[model samples]
Target: MSDSPHSTDGDTSRATLARVAEQAAVSMSTVSKVLNGRPGVAAETRARVETLLSEVGYTRRGAVVPGAPLIEIVFSELDNEWAMELIRGAGATAKLNGMGLIVTQSGTRHAPDPEWIDEVISRQPFGIILVMSDLPPANKDRLRRLQIPFVLVDPSGNPAPDVPSVAAANWDGGLQATNHLIALGHRRIGVIAGPHDVMCARARVSGYRAALESAGLPVDDDLVQPGDFHIEGGLVGGTALLESRDRPTAVFATNDLQAIGVYQAARALNLRVPEDVSIVGFDDLQFSNFSSPPLTTVHNPLYEMAREAARILLDIRAGSPVGTGRRELGTSLVVRESSVGPA
Candidate 1:
């Protein structure tokens, strides 16, 4: 004999359409019609059953629901105060736009991890903000494959053709700082540059050299040293520069942390700032103004840069094309007692 429509062949224990119908408080035929996507079931009945299916954790074969998209912010380093400030600015903007932020760390190794890109893609974030040092071609390709929108903050080299970026006017700031020292009659000027691989460091070095060349002064190789954008590196670099017989009348360190290191080195050497050797630094950090003689440095809007980056990411997520892929913010020279007429 033929089996009943709601029954399986001799398997009464198995759940069939009738069981689902009973649990959903609907007729067996109505459940059958809805399950088959037929035209007879009422819209309200269909919705009720669907809700029950979800609540009961039913997984229909070959079914998927689009998830909520998110945004990811990737940073190269998280230990520094500057990094913290950037996160605060980005976080504020993200919150304002009602978008979630997925913060990830890309180590200081050779390059960012391709696994990170894959993980980001798996999460299906609406966009990404790269606060990393520099991305290699492999990672870039992975990002391309995922088709995820991204913006870069303080990126190296020129902005990628399709990706938007925001950065400070580092080169111009360097020139301003160097020219300020030149105006003070500092013929023998020294520079403690950040790591060579860093784009900002390279740009500042270029600006410093340009200023010297523009002033008809020879660029002295002995007066320039490599600093790792750290206080200890600055201390070592400063000590080496100060110990030279032809010591510089003025010194320019890449950042305020380095500038503080310069101060410590000078104190050890019994050299009074501005009186014996004028000193200037970049990035007017919080403590720069509280130093012994108050550091004279270049003021770049770091928080503003981060905020703009977040805004750009939000716009991208909103399906708006960024008019310009690159934004370069300005910088100003902050004059203070730490720098004065060359002794």
Candidate 2:
């Protein structure tokens, strides 16, 4: 093999596998494995070497060098059931396409680390998928500068025109849930919306208003409460709604987790679901059907959404057009024991 470093210019010499190995604190053979896109190198080690190379300004000289197409998926958190389903779907699609999926959690922060992004780009991944909520402006700018193919999944706010995305029909799901209650003669409907800034939350709220408007019912501002998309937040919000003198006959929660919290709130207030009050939730997570009364919820295809996003990234890498900018899948309501006519 050629170990001699090539001279790039008057004063700088081209980086070699040995130099990268030394800088990354690994054996030269390991560096060669990564440089030539060979297998056997651990994911974390590969990322380290890739980051080192970029930090030292090393550029590989070749065309279409082949192996597994490394793709990094950055997520805001991994604690949620929906997020786990999304990961599983994306991972399966990546495997089918002969690509490797690297999942990294960004703590509770909104944006990913700039160094991490540099590492990902240095590895020359086939593509990237950002499954995050409200990525900061600085991170967006950095991503734009990388000039690599990428797609966003569940972006919480407006995204740059260049970045493509795949999302669910959240507004329609919300509208459907609200309309279902309205049709059951529930005029005093309360809303337990998720985080105020989250895109899904905002869309669901919009749908709720639309349903009320269609039914000629005035939107009651006092009946609506914001939750942090967590069970505890739901419990607090649900309790407040239940304690009101003019309690709503039915309630619509933005997610299954929140809906579960509402169940607790109902028990605390000595109210039986669908008998004294009705409840409907979104995102039919695994446990939704097993809830005390079996939640009536809108089914969000989390796994399908993830798979579609991965497929789109693969297409982009292959230089094939994956249709237009953004793609949105539909949602449907699942009737269960949690909802019925207003009492």
Candidate 3:
């Protein structure tokens, strides 16, 4: 029943937990936990109560502010060019800000294991950035209950409605890639639609279809094949497209990796690039420049996207304004030697 020191600012009466609770619009138990700097309350909620106490010239009995004060970056795997680029961007931002970053791989693409989620909670990071995947609702709820902020970078599927995300303009990139081929006077264009379940893949396909319709061309079923955004899918899908009797003159693979595999398929069929068949790919990866005759592709800045995601996550932690739940960087088309008028 010890009353804290009195406030000399206008009112000389000591502050009471009841008054704090009433002013904060929270229960007595919540005020108690906040004053004790307990982990049960939300960050924003805790910030609000702390602000109110400071304004009223009231000091908590023994509370220092509670913040885990670490940033974490989670990924499915960290073994690819794109992944390396993402790490560079995020790491650079963290270094400049004098913040330490914790990197972890979930060891699975579809989702992180339950133990991983538990580990995240135990660490209690200030913010988290999930690359190439989104947390399940249950996992997200756990984070929410703990009041930890998180964002997704290039999630395989659409993020939760309230979740924050950063991504590239997959649809626009797709449209531009297709349009570039069409402008080259290639009427019969083929496309390798990426994995069926990937949101970006579906978007690219839609863009390809839209571009074809805009050019008054039909989207032929035989011309659109499935891809997995990897070499194997490209090799298999590309082979099927090239073997068709009514094969397209040009093909747009969902990504550069797949496009290179397509080149292997074409070479097996004795089809020389550009002279016999034109190709356009997405993701202007470093390897794209060295592919035979080079590659005409869309440049998706994965690094910049990662940097921005880190910046945005920090901004969220600071309680600043984020324009939208989702942010998408623009993409550009790099016309290289791999594309030309079809023979």
Q: Which candidate is the best by TM-score?
A: 3
TM-score of each: 0.73, 0.78, 0.79
Residue lDDT tens for model 1, 68-134: 2356778877777677777778777877766667788875423556557446644556567787534
Candidate number with the higher TM-score (2 or 3): 3
- Report the error of model 2 at residue 283, Å: 1.1
Residue 37, model 2: lDDT of 52
| RMSD (Å) of each candidate, 1 decimal | 12.7, 7.3, 7.1
Return the top candidate by lDDT. Answer: 3
Model 1: worst 10 consecutive residues (lDDT sum) = 59-68
TM-score, cand. 2 = 0.78
- In Å, residue 180's CA in model 2 sits off its true spot by 1.1
Candidate 3: list runs displaced more than 4 Å: 1-69
Residue 112 accuracy (lDDT) in model 1: 55
Model 2, span 253-313: residue lDDT tens: 9888999999999999999998988999999998999998999999998899889988887
Whole-model lDDT for model 2 versus the true structure?
Answer: 0.76
True-structure lDDT of candidate 3: 0.79
- For residues 195-278, write the lDDT of model 3, one tens digit per residue: 877898888888999999999999898998999989988899999999999989999998998999899999999999989999
Clashes of each: 0, 0, 0
Q: What is candidate 2's CA lDDT for residue 216?
A: 98
> How big is the positional error of residue 216 in model 2, measured in Å on the Cα after superposition?
1.0
Indicate whether candidate 2 or candidate 3 has the larger lDDT: 3
In order of TM-score, best first, we have: 3, 2, 1
Residue 332 lDDT in candidate 2: 96
